[model samples]
Target chain A: MTTIITAQNLSKSFGSFQALKNVNLTIKKGQIVGIIGANGAGKTTLLNSILGLSVYDGDLNVLGFDPYSQRDELMKEICFISDVATLPKWIKVSEAIDFVEGVHKSFDRKKALAFLAGTTVPLDKKIRQLSKGMVVQVHLALIMSIDAKILVLDEPTLGLDIIYRKKFYHQLLEDFFDEDRTILITTHQVDEIENILSQVIFIREGEIALEADMEEITENWMVLNPTADNIDAARASSPASEQSLLGRTSFIFNGVSRAELEKLGDVSRVSLSDLFVTLMKGDNDA
Target chain B: MIASIIKPGGYNPFKALMLREYWENRRAIFTTPLVIMGLSMVLIIISMGLLGRAIHIDGQSYTLNEMIANMSAQKAQNISTHINQILMVSTLPIMIGAWFCMVFTALGSLYDERKDNSILFWKSMPVSDLQTVLAKLLNVMLVIPFVAIGFTFIFQIFLLIVGSFSTLGTDYSAWDLLWSSSNLPLLVFSELTYMVMYSLWALPVFAWFMLVSVIAKRSPLLLATIPVALVILFETLFFHSEYLARFIGMRLTGAHILQTDNGFGQNFSILGINTPLENIQSAAKPEFWIGLGIAAALLYAAILLRKRSSL
Candidate 1:
C-alpha cells in the first residue's frame, strides 16, 4: 500500500489553547478513513492543517508537499468540502462552474453539470437563493467533478437531510472512489458513514484514542450481552465499557477472547459507533 | 523576485483569474461608467432643449444658426476645440465615479471573501495568493480605469452625433466644422496617458486599501481610513508637522508627473500631453519610485496575510 499522508509530532495552538497536541497519524492511498470526534476535538484543526488552510508545528506532508508552504501545488491533487456552505452567495451556479473549470485543469465541466442535473440547483440562480440543502449539493457537485488524488470532507453532509446524506455517500463510493484516490472524512455522525469507512481514527481531546482498520477493530472488539445471572462474571472480565437497557446489561470488551466473552452470554461484533462510544467514554472515565 | 514569481507558467491562470475578477465585479467595473454617461447624456439633452439655438462656450455666447452661417475658419476651429474640451471635461464625473468604484472594490474584494468564508473555496483551487492579489490590484488599477475611459470615449461620440443632428439643415455642417477640426485622436492619446499616470501615481494608496481589506476582521472601510486619520492627527498634535499630510495630499491630487505646466483644464494642444521622454524622466522622480516600492511592499504583505488567513 502507498502511504499518501503522514503526520509526525503535529502540534497547533491558538493563543493559549492547544488545538492539536503532538499527534502522529498515517493514511494510505485508497482507504476511506473516517476521523470521528466530538465537537472541538481537533478534527477541524487537523483537517485544516492537511488542507494548508492553517499553519502548524512539526512535520506533515501530503502528496510529497508541505501543505502550508506548497499549497498551490498540493491543491492540484487535493480537494475538500468544508463543513459550512462556502460558495460565494453572489456567484451564480453556472459562473461557479465556469470559474472552477477555468482554473482547475482537471475540472470536468460536463461532469459538474451532470451532477447538478439531478438536483434542484438551477444554473442561473445565485447561491444565496438556493436552500441550504441545495447549496451543499452544489458544493458537492463541484468537488466530485475534480480529478484529485485525495478528497478531504469536513462534515460535508452537515445539516443535510437523510436522503441527501445517504445519496451523497453512495455517489461518492460509486463515482469518485478508486484505487488511485484516498478519502479523509470528519464528522460527528459516526454511524452514518461507518459502512463506507475502511479505517477509523477516534480523536478525543486533541489526541488519537484509537486508530485501527475496520477489519481489525471488528475482529478484536466484541459486545457481550451478559445474562443477569452472569453479570458479575462479565464485570470481573473488566470490559472497556458497560451499558444497561431494558433490565439487560451489555458489556463492550476490546481484545478479550471471543470464546471467553461467549462464556458470559451472547457475543457479537461491535458497531463502529458503539466502539467509538466505548473508547471515548472509557478515555473520559480514565 | 516579483517578476520571476509571475514569469514561469503563470499566464493561463493569471488570465483566468482576471476573467474571474471581471465576472465578480462587472457591475462596479463596467456599469458604473455607463450609468454615469447615461445620466449625463440625459441632462445634456434636456439642457440643449431648454437653451435652444444659443450655444455657450467658455462664457462666450454664440447664436448657433447665425454663427455657423458667417463662421470663419478660425472660429470653426475654436468652437471645435471647445466642444472637444467639453467632451473631455464631461468624463470627469465618470472618472470620479470610477475612482469611487475602484476604492470600494478594493476595500471589499478580499474582505468580503473572508467574511463570507468564500476564501476557503477560492483557496481550494490551484491559484497562488500572489495571483489572487495581483488580479484584484489589476482590476482596481487597470480594469476600472480603462472601462471608465472607454465609456467616456463612447459618450464623446454620442455628444458629437447629437451636435451633428443639431446642425442637420445648416449650410455649414458640424461634420465640416466640428468633425474635421476635432482633435479626437490626440484627446484619446492624452486621456490614455493621464489614466496610466494616475494609476501609477495612486498605486500605493490602492495597495494600502487592499492590505487593510485582507487584515481587517470587520469594517474594512474604517480600518483602512482610521489609521491614516490618526497618523495625520498625531503628527499635527505632537510633531507639529504637515509632512505626512502633504505627502498624502500629493498622492491624492495630481502630481507633477501627471500634470503639465499648463495644467489639466487647458486646451488639448499637441504639446499639452507630456512627451514619452518627458514621461520617462518624470517617472524617474524619487517620490514616484518610492510610491511604487511602497505599493509592492504592501501587496507582498497582503499576499502573505491572505495565505495564512483561515477566516
Candidate 2:
C-alpha cells in the first residue's frame, strides 16, 4: 500500500491545556477514511496539525514531506474544505472564484463555474447577499474545482441543511471521488458517509481508539439477539455490544466468523454507528 | 498510489500567498491613493484660506513661473511650519491607514483561514514554511509601504497644484510651485522614498501584528496595543528613559516626519555662526538601520511561525 500520511507521536499544547497527546496515524492512498469522535476529542486538532496549521511537537509526513515545513507546496496537491461558508462575505461568488483561480494553479475555473451553472448565485452579487446554504454551495464548488490528490473535509456539511448535506455528499461522490483519489473525512455523524468509507478510524481524546477495515468490521462486529438461556454461551464468545432486555441478552462480537456468530443466535450486519459505539466500549475487552 | 507531485525543488508556495494577499487588497482599494491625494488638495485650499495667505514670488520677474517657488519650502519658515503641521497631523492618519491595513490583512491572513479551518488546503500544498513566511513578510512590510507611497505622492502633488492656484492674490503661483526652483520631481521622489524607507524601518511593528493575528484567538491588534499603552503609562508615571522612548515609546508619538537631507539652504543667524548643510546631521544613522534590521528579522520570525501555525 502506498502511504499518503504518516503521523507519529504527535502532541500539541495550548498554554495550560493540552489539546493533543501522543497521537499516531497512517493513511493509505485510494482509501476513504472516516473519522468519528465527540466534541473536543481532538479530532479538529489532529486535522489541523496534519494540515500544518498549528505548531506541534511530533513527526508528520503527508505525501512524503513534513507537513509543518512543506505546507504550501503540499497544499497544491491537497484539497481541504473545512467549513461550508468559507468564502469571504464581501466578495461576490464569481470574484471569489476568480481569485481562487488566480491563486491556485490546480483550481479549474471552468469546472467551478460549471458547478454553479444554473444557480441563482449571480456572479456579481456579494457573498454577504447570498443565502447561507448558497454560500456553502459556492465554497463546495470551489473545493471540487481544485484537482488535489488528497481531500481533507472537516465538517464540510456543518450548517448545511439535511437535504443539501445529502446532495453535497452525493455530488462529491459523483464528481470528485475516484479510485486514484484519497479522502479523509471527520464528523460525528457516521451513518451519513457510511456506505462510501473503506475504513473507519475512531479517535477518542487524542488517540486512535480503533482502526478497522469495512469487511473485517462486518465480520467481527455482530449484534447478537438470543434468549437468556444462551447468554452464557454468547458471553463466552466475548460479545462486544451486549444488551439485556428482561434479561434476554443481545451481544456484538469482534474477531469471530459470521458462521460462528450465527451459532450464538440472530447475528446480522452492524451499522457503522453501532459498530463505532460497540467497538469504543468493547475495545480490548472483546 | 502516492502521487509524485511533491518532489523537492519545486515552485515556491510563499510567492503564491504573497500574490494572493496583494491582489485582494489591490482590488479593494487600488485607486485609494490618487483619490485621497485629490481630496487633500481640496483641504489645502481650505488651509490656505485659514492662514489668510496669498501666493506670489518676488525673486524674479512677477510671473506664474516665479510664483510656484514661494509655495515650496518656506521663503521664511512660514511654509515650513505649514508643511510641518500638514506632515505632523497627517502622519497619524497615514499610520492609521497602515495600521488598519496591516491589522486587517494580517488578521484575515491566517486567522480567517484558521477560523474556517482551511489549514487542510494549505497543508497539502508543496511549499515550505520558510517560503510561506517570506511571502507574508513581503506582503505586509513591502507591499504596504509601496501602497502608502502611492497615496503620499498623489497627496503631495494635489497640495502643490491647488496650493499654487489658491494663493492667486498672494505669493503662490502654479508656475512657481511647479517650476520656479523646487524641482518637483526630485522633491516628491525624495519624500516618497523617505516614506517607503520609514515603513521598511518600521517593518517589525507590522510583522509583530501579523504574528499576533496568526496566533491570537481574536482582536490581535487591540490586544497588542495594550502592551504599548502600558509601557507609555508606566514610563510617564515613573522615571524617564530616552533609550526606551527612542526604541519603543517614541514610535508611539511618531515625532519624526520624513527625515530627508534635501540640502535646500544653509541658515545663518545674526547672533552666532550657523552650521552649514554639510555639518547637519544625516537622516539615516547606524543605530536606526540596526533597529530596522532587527525589526525586519522580527517580522521574518512571524512569517516562520505563521508558516507552521495551524490556521
Candidate 3:
C-alpha cells in the first residue's frame, strides 16, 4: 500500500508550552486511523500540523506535498470536517452548494443535491435555521460530494444525539470509504467508532503512547479474569492494568500468549476502550 | 466518477469569492443604495407637488411649466447648471452610506469568521489566503462604490424624466429644457473616474481596517481605533504636529494636495462638472502612490496573519 502521510520529528509550540513533541508517523492508504487522546493531549495540535492550519517544525508530508507550504494544492485532494456546525450561519443551503460547485473542481453539485434529497434539510433555508443535526447532515453531504483522497475529522459529531451520531458514521463508511482513500478521526467517543477504526494511536502529553494496527492489538493483547486462588499467579504475569469490578478481578496483558493467560483464568481479546484506559494509566504510572 | 475526473474548468474561484462577499453583505452593498433611491424618489415627488404652485420671479407670478418656458437662453443655462450640480452632489448620500458599509464590512470580514469558527471551513477550501483577503478588499473598495453608482444613475434618470414632464405643455421640449442642457455622458464619466481615484486615495484606511480585523481577537473596532487615537494624541502632545491628522482628513475628504485651495469646497460654483477630470490628475501625486504602497504592505500582512491564525 502507498503511504499517504508521513511526519518525521514534527514539533509545534505556543509561546512557552510545546504542544506536539517530535511526532513521527506514517499512514498508509485505505487505513481508518483513530487518534485517541485526552484534553490538552496534543491530538488537535497534530491534526492542525497535518492539515497545514498551524505552523510546525521538522519534516512533514501529505499526498506528496508539504502541507504547511502547499496547503492549497493539498486541499484539492483533501476534505475535512473540523468540529461540528462550521458552516456559516448566513449561507443558504442552496448557496453553499453553489459556492462549492463554483470553486472546488472536484465537487459534484448533483451528488451534493442527491445526498441532501435524502435528508430533511431545505435548500432555501439559511444554515442558522437548520437544527444542529440537520446542519451536520448538510455538512456531511457537502463533504461526501467531493472526490477527495483523504478525509480528516476532528470530533465531527461532538454534540449530536446518539441517533444522528450513529447515522453519521454509518453514512460515512457506506458512502465515502474506499480502498483508494484514507481517513483520520479524533473523538472523545471512542467505543462508537472502534468498530470502524483499522488502526489506533494514543497520544498523551505531546507524546505518542501507543500506535498499533487493530489486528495486531487484538492478536497480542488479552484480558483475563482469574479464579480467587490464581490471582497472585495472574499478577506474576505482569498485566498492563488491573480492574476490580463487583467481586471479580480482571487483568489486561500485553505481548502475552493466550495459552498462558488461559492457564490463569478465562481470557478474551481486549476491547479498544480497555486498551485506551490501560495505555493512559500506564503513562500516568510512569 | 469518470465525469468527476475531468476538472471543472468554467468555474472561476475568484469570481466565486467575489460573489461570496456579495452574498454575505448583500444588505450593506445593495439594499442601502436602493433604499436611498426610494427615499430620494419620495422627496422628489413631494417637491414636484410643491413646485406645481405659482412662483413669482421678479414679482411676476407663473406656474412651474410657465417659469421654465419664460426663461431666456442665459437664464435657462444658469438654472440648468444649478440643477446639474444638485443632481451630481445628490450622489453624496449613497456614497457616504457605502463608505460606512465598506468600513464595517472590512472590519468584520475576517473577525466574524473566527468568531463563529467558520474560518476552519473556509480554510479547508482549496483557495489561497491571498485570494480570500483580496476578494474582501476589492469587494469593499470597488464593488460597493460601483453598486452605489448604479443606483445613483437610476435616481438621476428618474429625476431627469420628472424634469422633462415638468417642462411639458410649454414652449421648451424635454431636449431643450433638460436633456440638451445637461452633459450626462461627461458627468457619468467623471463620476466613475472620481470613484476610482477616491478608492485609490482611501485604500490605506480600508487595508488598515482589514489588518485590524485579522489581528484582533475581540472588539476589532476598539482595537482599530485606539492605536490611531494614540498616534494622533502622541503626535499632538509632544511633536506639536498634525501631519498625520491632516493626511487622514485629506484621504477621508476628496481634497487632494494638487488642488490650489487644498479643498474641494472652492472647486466649483453652480456645477462640479470639471472635478472628475481634475481628480484624475491627483493620481500623479506622490502621496497617491505612497498610499497604494502602504495598502499593499497592510494587505500582505493580513494575508500572512490569516494563514497563521487558528480557529
Candidate 4:
C-alpha cells in the first residue's frame, strides 16, 4: 500500500496554550487508522492542519500535496465528515446535493441521490426539521458518494443509532471504500470501530501516547481475573497491576502470553473500549 | 494511483462556492432589503401626493415636468441625498449584512468542517486554498451584489408603478411619472456597478476577515475587531497621534478608488437627469483609471496573501 498522509513535528498553539505539540503520524493508503483521544486532545486540530484549515508549525502531505499550499489538489482526493447536522440548515436535501455537485467535481449525484433514497430523509424537506440521525445519514450519503481516495471522519456518527451507525460504516466499506482508499476516523465510539481499525494511535495532552497495530495489541495485552484465593500467586506471576475491591491483582503474566493466554480461567480477550481504558489509565506511566 | 495537482484548470471553484453561498442565504436576501425598499417607496408615494395636493390648492398650473423639476430641486436634493444614504444604509448594510451573513452561511464553509472534523472531505476535493478562498470572496463581492440588485430593482420598479397610482388631481399621467423612475434603472445600475467596482477595492479586507474567521476558535469578528479598536482607542487617548490616524485613515480611504460618481464637478453649461450621466461618462477622468488600477493591485495582493497563508 502507498502512503496517503504523513505528518512530522506538527504543532498548533492558541495564544499561550498549545493545542498540539510536536506530533508525528503517518497513515498508509487503504489502512483504517483510528485516532483515539479525549476532547481537546488535538485530534481535530491535527485533522484541520492536514486539510489546510488551520496553520500549524509542521510538515504534512496528504496524497503528495501539502494540504496548506496545495489544498485544491489535496481536496480532490480527501473526503471528510464531521457532525452531520452541519451539512446545511436551510437547504432541502436535493439543494444540498446540488451544492456539493457544484463545489466538488468528483461528487456523484446519482450515488448521493440513491443513498438519500435509501434513507427516510424527506427529499424536499429542509434539513432544519430532520432529526440528528437523519442529518448524519444525509452527510454520509454525500460523503460516501464522493470518489475521494482519503476519507476523514470526525465523530461522523455522533447521534446515530446502533443500526444506522453499523449501516453507515458497512456502506462506507462496501460502496465507498476500496483497497486504495484510506480512512482516518477520530471518534469516541472505539469498540464499534475495533474490528475495522488496522492501526490505532492514542494522543494525550498534545502528544502521541501510543501507536499500535490491532492484532499485535490483542496478542500482547491481556486481562487477568483470578478467582483463586492465593491472589499473591497471580500477583507474582503477572507483569501489570490491576485495581480490585478484594485486593491488588495483576493482569501481567508470562503464562498468558499470546499463544496460550486463552487457557487461563475466564481469560476474556480485551475489547477496544477496554483496551482504550487500559491505555488511558496506562499512558501516564508509559 | 493518479495524482491531483493544483494546476490551472478550466473549472472555477469560486463560482460554485458563490452559488451555494447565495442559495444558503436566501432568507436574508429576500426579506431584509425588500422590507427597507418597500417602506422607502411607501414614504416616497405619500410625500409626493402631499406635495402634489399642495400644488393643486395653490392654483399653480404646473406641468408634471415642472412639478418633478420642483420636487427634484427641493425634495430631489433630499431625495438624492437620501438615495445616496439609502443606497449606503439600505443597500450597503444589506450588502454588508450579506457579507456578514457569509459569516453564518459560510461559518461552516471550512471552519465547521474543521470543527466537526470534515476538513478531510473538502481537502479530498480537487481544490486549492486559492480556489477555496476565491470562491468565498466571489460569493461576497460578486454574487451578493447580483442578488441585492435583482431584489431591489424589481422592488423599485414595483414601487414606481405604485407611486404612479399615488398621484392626485388626475392631471399627471402615470406614464410620465414611470418614465421618470424608468430612467433610473440605468442610473441606479450604472452607479451601483461603479460602487461595486469600487467595493472590489476593499475585498482584501473581506479576505482578511475570512482569514480571521478560519482561524479563530471563538468569534472571528471580535478577534479582528478588538485589535483595530485598541489601536483606535490608543490614538484617541493620545489625541496628537497624527501618525497613527494618518496611517489607518489612508489605508481606509485607499479603498475608495471606484468613486466614479464625482462626475463633471460644476462644469456643465446645461443640466438635467440626462445631463449628469452623459457628462460623467463622456468626461473620462484620469482619477477613474488610476483608482481602477489601484483596486486591481489590491485584489492581486489579496489573492497572493491568500495563497501564502495556510488555510
Candidate whose TM-score is highest: 3
Which lDDT value does model 1 have at B138?
92
List lDDT for all candidates, in order.
0.83, 0.64, 0.85, 0.62
Q: Rank the candidates by lDDT, best first.
A: 3, 1, 2, 4
Task: List the candidates ranked by TM-score, beginning with the highest.
Answer: 3, 1, 2, 4
Off by over 4 Å in 2: A9-24, A56-58, A227-237, A244-249, A263-265, A282-286, B1-19, B22-35, B38-142, B148-182, B232-240, B249-284
> Which interface RMSD does candidate 1 score?
3.8
- Give me the TM-scores of chain B across the candidates: 0.85, 0.62, 0.86, 0.60
Winner by DockQ between candidate 3 and candidate 2: 3
- Best of the two (1, 4) by lDDT: 1
Q: What ranges in model 1 sit over 4 Å off?
A: A282-286, B1-11, B50-77, B260-281
Between candidates 2 and 4, the lDDT winner: 2
Answer with 1 or 3, whichever has the higher TM-score.
3
| A149: Cα error in model 2, Å | 1.8
Better of 2 and 3 by TM-score: 3
Calculate each model's fnat, 2 decimals: 0.60, 0.39, 0.66, 0.41
Q: What docking tier does model 1 reach?
A: medium
* Maximum-DockQ candidate: 3
| Model 2 lDDT tens row, A128-213 | 79887787778778778888888888888887788888887888898899887899898766889999899878876667777787
Tens-digit per-residue lDDT, B156-267, candidate 1: 8887788777677866667776677667777777777777877887788889999999999899999999989999999999999987777766676646565555644453
